[model samples]
Target: MGSQELEEEELVQMVRDFIESESPSSPSFSSSQGLGTFNQQPNYLTLQEILGSVEDTEDEVHQKILKYLRNKNTAWKTTNLKKWLVMRLRMDGYDASLCRTSWVTTYNCPGGDYEYIDIMMDNDENGGVGRLIIDIDFKSQFELARPTTSYAQLTDTLPCIFVGCETKLNKIISILCTAAKQSLKESGLHVPPWRGTNYMQSKWLSDHCQKVQPIPRISSNNS
Candidate 1:
């Protein structure tokens, strides 16, 4: 193999070994111990938990969101889109809401706020309700100005829109941050604080976030 090809292979192996070492002994979620309400402290997830098969409900919800997007007639601004989806999902008997997360500039990372949609649904997993995070622009979060071939391939696997639970997102951030660090080092670039794992985690998992349930729109006849 060429020198560059050898380097890419080495990078892949390094990531694999790291993830293997980080794999947790217990699964992230199960029927018996379902992912509880968002108010509960989240369980830390590992490589194995993320690599496992997608839960049936997660897949179903994913498809449903895709269908909703596909059927929409008008282009939507992010704020309006989130509000509409929140109302739509709520009308469908799903406990959905618009969530906004903000962070302060820390020594390690910069501060920022983000908006996304989430649903608390009992996805037929033995009547367990789980919070599913929905990001319309999931893939873009991991984009790099100039990425190594190996790193690019890793990111290409991410869905344009992400609809999954905290456990799944945790593992993704861990893997991507590591890849991004190596890619930046190879390119002789400084890794930005925003691209770090902690920063990315705060976008979705921070306790300081605000979750707002949209007030239902009333018709004129109601007055």
Candidate 2:
């Protein structure tokens, strides 16, 4: 066999390994259950449940973000918006900061990086630390080129701005990835590896994430 043939063989084995690894670990509503027994909820109910489950601090931070967006200047870019939000949250006495995660390419997945806002808070009851994730365009992450009615409805239930804990994010990613694979199959399209649940989870759940405070840009005229 030629060198090209060897490379092809290695790539094929990598994909097979990825498939095997994803099987038994796929998440569901509960850790002990599987997606087979999962029930789909109506869009409104799903959103309501997600929004209602947040802690008081998370809900307050989410509302602040919404109001910030409503009064945002059209000229502000996404990066600026995040910086401003982080600054505002810190001023308001929240431990909010910008977080970015990057992963290297593996045989079964491509390398990529993602940035989002995270707030660290001390749990009052347990006296433990908790982290709340805030993704500005959370819904758009799972969008497909073409989708079945059911898949579209499922994605519609995702919040535009995701404000939840790690556990909640994990459950949502699992549900969406399962639906996405089905939707692609029904549309006669191949499901890409990046759309896998593992890949989605890596964006936020990876231990390699870097957190930092964004400095507010000073006007040149101020000098």
Candidate 3:
């Protein structure tokens, strides 16, 4: 079994917590609506409204925002590791003013602490490097990109993210995997693909995925 290493910067772990809290309550999920003014309604805030109050935000918030944006209009259906990452957030920062002007109407992108994240892309779909001002995304428990492999020649190091639950990043990874497999299948390469599992994930694919590879994380206890 691969041993989990302790993190150096303690804040890295805390960012995960913050992202999750962002979407603490689902918009459609509401208490029982009965006779007179019966239960409370789920609080659904617009993306711009969310960014406005970013003096502080929970990690869940980031998760929700990403999730919403991704599935919002199927725009995220074809994102790559390089494009759909936090880099996307950086690009959106360029039009902070325009975004604010468009806020009441078309400001759908989630807010970021732009002072820390540098905007270099001309569009939100573009990707590049940006400074991480604050460790304000994804929780440690729900951390994305567990180290798996190292590409350097000087030293040997272990890498690979753990597959346990429905971390937003994992779900995003799965979406990429699904997209890749779909492409391979279209090319007739997935006819006899290696089997994966649905072992131990926090969130899983919908019921429609009939012939998915058994990613050990979501399948058996062979870990």
TM-score of every candidate: 0.70, 0.72, 0.19
lDDT digits (tens) for residues 91-156 of candidate 2:
666778899998988887778888888988888889999998987667679999999877876665
lDDT by residue for model 3 (134-209), tens: 2122222222122211111000110011111223223334433343344445555541222121221111222222
Candidate 1 residue runs with Cα over 4 Å from true position: 1-52, 75-79, 123-128, 217-223
Worst 10 residues of 2 by lDDT: 28-37
* Over 4 Å off, model 3: 1-76, 79-82, 94-223
Per-model CA lDDT versus the true structure = 0.67, 0.68, 0.25
TM-score of 2: 0.72
Q: Candidate 1, residues 1-223: lDDT per residue as tens digits?
A: 5785564455334423433432244332221233324312222233324534577667766656555555554413333566666766666566778999998999998999988888887757488788889876676688998998667655655655577889879888988898889899999999989989999999999887898856664332210
Worst 10 residues of 3 by lDDT: 150-159
Count of backbone collisions within predicted model 3: 34
Candidate ranking under TM-score, highest first, comes to 2, 1, 3
For residue 88, give model 3's deviation from the true position in Å: 3.6
Candidate 2 yields a Cα-based lDDT of 0.68
Name the best candidate (by TM-score). Answer: 2
